[model samples]
Target: MTSSIHNEVIIFSQAAGDTIHILDLYEKNRKNTKFSIYVIKNKNIYDYFNELDLRLKNLVFIPYPKRFGLYNIQLLRKEKKRINSLFKKHFINSVNHKIYFFAHVYDYLTMSFVLSLSKNNTVIFVDYDKYDTNKTLPKQFYHVKDKMLLTIYKYLVGKQLVLTEKKAIKLLFENTNIKSNKTDEVSSKIKEKYSHNIANQSTGNSVLIFETPTAEASIINYKNTMIEILNILVKAGYKIYIKPHPYKGFSPFLRNYNVSICNANVPGELINTSGFNFIFGINSLSICRLAIDRYGSIYSLIQLFTFRRLNEKDYNIKYLLGQSNEKILFINSLNHLDKILAKR
Candidate 1:
């Protein structure tokens, strides 16, 4: 008897964090598998992954369209034809092979292409953030102007979804139409592969701050609040390092503060968290993830600032962190943060 090979295709268009998820999937299934990756290029995400040591041979980068609406039907058609051609070239006689698609939910071009190829394939939506399904599904199904496109997306997805956390599986079942049989969980095994081997007894006096793109979204005065936090950390005699968000680099004003800056291209999850006594962020999924893995004392500074526009997704960080067995703290005020530092 001989084992059968699995043909898997992954399509994604998101931030550097998503690339980490895709890498995790590839690392797990690379052996005895025919893999093809299609990344809908957005910003420096492609460039960041291209520089990684993981030599993905069949990686395909597709440039995202500037406009993808009714006015650009010709452009859409051209892109669709190109994608179909690429699929045909990559998976010859795809009907005979059982093709599985692990994809993110956004990006019209990639989703449309996946719909075309999904007639004889399995399409599983990969949600990097476990709490995102509720927010994303509503926007796609209700708000999208293209009813045909929405129908195609829904039909292809067909109740299959993948999440990074196991605890979120019940939440998905309770909230969505996705059945328990079709919902799959892929743990963040990439963290284990790259995590530092620090002793359980060691507790350092350094802090690592994971920056978010709140400033880019104009949600809050990110720079001023960051400066305030930096000052508090400095006065408490703690070494500070800030990991700039992959998509949004911090303002130059942060340079005036006494803190070392990390490379913006690297994923926060990939960084070693052993040396730090504290890992801080404003509702960053990276913070919660590292905390769950018992890397450091993770903290969220979400209460210290207020967003101009409210987003439900931003509020889920606390909920997710609460599920962790480890103690993940939330900083409510600068004074409260000072008190915690004093205790430390």
Candidate 2:
């Protein structure tokens, strides 16, 4: 269903769970106009939003979580119906402003629902590349099929407002004609030109980002992976520093690691001027490229576990890791990590 008038814009995102903070910034920037966010909740979105104080005085955030996990077609259809119902209940029939729908993930279920309900509305796909680092995928959710869905969504969506050309290349080149050489050339140039404005480095201490299942399904084994990475880097005389993926939920487990955790408020100026190296989970492409241009490597523990999870006969871990050289140096199990890093 379309929004009532031409005066408002609503951001439609999956699980008001993760993106509320990001939307807060958007709401602030567009505060002059009537802007609302419709967050389709799957879990306990209200609790999460309340905990974070995501409720703003002007920006109306709707938490619409379904009671069931839509694992099959029947449930998916039901979920679609539920989402459509919410949009109609909230937006359709109003006449003051044109309604805009910003789809964040653009997955099949959500995409299908939006297409059906868009009837007379403007639909935009968010999740710009400036936000992506193209390093890793979340473990608890997401699948190869989602990648296919994203390809389709990009084709159908009105516009793609990516952060950087490098990110655009990464998204378009997933299975296209954009040559890796050309992409790398553009990526390097972008970093070189923009480094002065965006690049941040740590001068004295370094932080290792241990992103758990929250970062993506590809790199969920946080404990063993973190230990292996720390042990190897420690042996190499690197001091210990750790932080969670900015979007990852708070962890009591990290206390045991004796590390520091940071959030969105941490100034990019601080990271840019401090000369710190971010060893992180590559959920966003910008972070991966940033690390490569500044730190020379992206230490993603998830990549190691993902390789192990792949069918041994189907893919050679060493060869795959070797080919993905953008910011990756090596992917290894704990037993072989030291030996591999020794060679690097």
Candidate 3:
């Protein structure tokens, strides 16, 4: 270390809401005199992180227009040259023994530029490519493509960090064809378990965080389903709190229901502090895993919302995901929930 005065950590994403939580964590860490951080932003998603109280000696925000015009395949050669130039000017300067780049997802563009600037020193790669709810044809293509890109990513990046999920790990292996028996499963479990405990300790009627249908661009038949479930929970005489997906925007469907819709950003601390039982959407199994000790997967509920069939492979996936056979709850609708609950 050459008494380096500046250290930079660039986070690449347009979705500031999720990444801000990571930045908040970095801000709270113990500070040393050796390194300072410059929080780089692309697409101008800097406002969310700016609001946080950070003790870092310096923070630099860089925002640029995403290469919207270059989405066409025919323009990639020209686009590649232009992108290279921009990366050299803006992103390359941040690479040093004192500097690091935290690529949020398997963004090929960001990763490519980082590799070009990479030397023998410090470059920390953080991969946070969680599942997306959008089930569109175009997005599906991108998802498969991203898998291949991420595999290549594991080799080039100085460090590969992933969330503790078996499906994600399997996907990475399938995409990258890289067999590493050394793959580390870093758990965000502390946060999740702490929140679970908080929810249990709280005194009040339980809150039910609903995964809205229109997450990403796909629509699930949620209106009727949520209504059906709420009626049962209401009849059970439990007060309900409802929280929607952040990107799904405000839900009008919840207005007529007996549930209270929470519109603000409810942090993990609050989720831990507040008592709530999760009523899952078809795709909300992941979030519910963070809440309770166990989860009941309604395979029939999946059939109710999705036209796609849930086969043995789907159950195998769920089983591989740490859920036992008994934990899987296959029900047609809320009406069937009463019979299931009675048996429980």
Candidate 4:
């Protein structure tokens, strides 16, 4: 069958970050290659994938069941064969298959197992969407349980935890690194969709808010917590705007408050972040890069919440991610935000 010189099969789940960056890489570096994207556990966000750049035609979804533990190499082989079958379904006839992943902790597990199937094939890792934390698998998962899980995943996969390049020695121990900083393509598209001028959006004191529903299990007083932020902003006489996560529906609030919802596709980074005094989120990692870029201070309330439903390891991961990056400030309470804002 006639095809591009190289055939790449990218294993990614989320449409927003990693997948978008992969498209950006393909757009910038037009290597003569045909490719397909394999999504893991994509049932919920299947609709969200459509919003990605229209270049990729074939998107295959492979759900990871909880029963198949991390150490199951045989199960992984079975999954890869299913993926091969998926390739057949798509009639993707190219032996030159190089699997690509963004190399976050969990998705790395999926991509590594897939890479193991083709032992000789090259596996590429990108750090497009992951938060630039000093933390990674080894550092984050130093505890016995997580360490054992990561170890088992590596052992079963058999492929080395190769990061981006020679300069990214730190990421060798970590999971991801700064590879391609091409969030522009996706950001531009989002901006075009929104088309709201930054000046128009922010007339006076305003702050952008992000609500991560995925992390709500760990968040103790979800509604009250959101209300608390809104209340604080209201008392400070700040006009509040919320950009609800695509997965997490907007939190319900009485229309009496000045708080409003943003339906635009604009990412926090794309927005004129300088216009706002502060940016707030509940464990939403997407805005870290933007927070770093803009002169304004960014804060997170992840540590303020309780995680009764979530495991201790998972809860700790969220806590660490808050203080992990210098760009974002992790506050345990709304009261703490006053001092930081005072400095600003």
What is the lDDT, from 0 to 100, of the residue 175 in candidate 3? Answer: 30
Report lDDT per candidate: 0.58, 0.41, 0.43, 0.54
Candidate 4, residues 224-285, lDDT tens digits: the string is 76677677777777888777665455655534567767643444444556567778776665
Could you say which candidate leads in lDDT?
1
Candidate 3, run of 10 with poorest lDDT: 164-173
Candidate 3 wrong stretches, greater than 4 Å: 1-29, 33-48, 57-90, 97-109, 127-203, 213-220, 248-252, 255-258, 263-270, 278-281, 285-304, 308-333, 339-344
TM-score of each candidate? 0.70, 0.50, 0.55, 0.60
**With candidate 1 superimposed using the best TM-score fit, by how many Å does residue 59's alpha carbon deviate from the native?**
1.7
Tell me, what's the RMSD of every candidate?
6.9, 10.4, 8.3, 7.4
Candidate 4, position 176, lDDT: 31
How large an RMSD does model 2 have? 10.4
On TM-score, the leading prediction is: 1
> Could you give candidate 2's per-residue lDDT for residues 155-244 as a string of tens digits?
433222122211221222232221222112223332232222222323444544534335334345645655666666657544444433
Full ranking by lDDT: 1, 4, 3, 2
Count of backbone clashes, every candidate in sequence: 0, 29, 3, 0
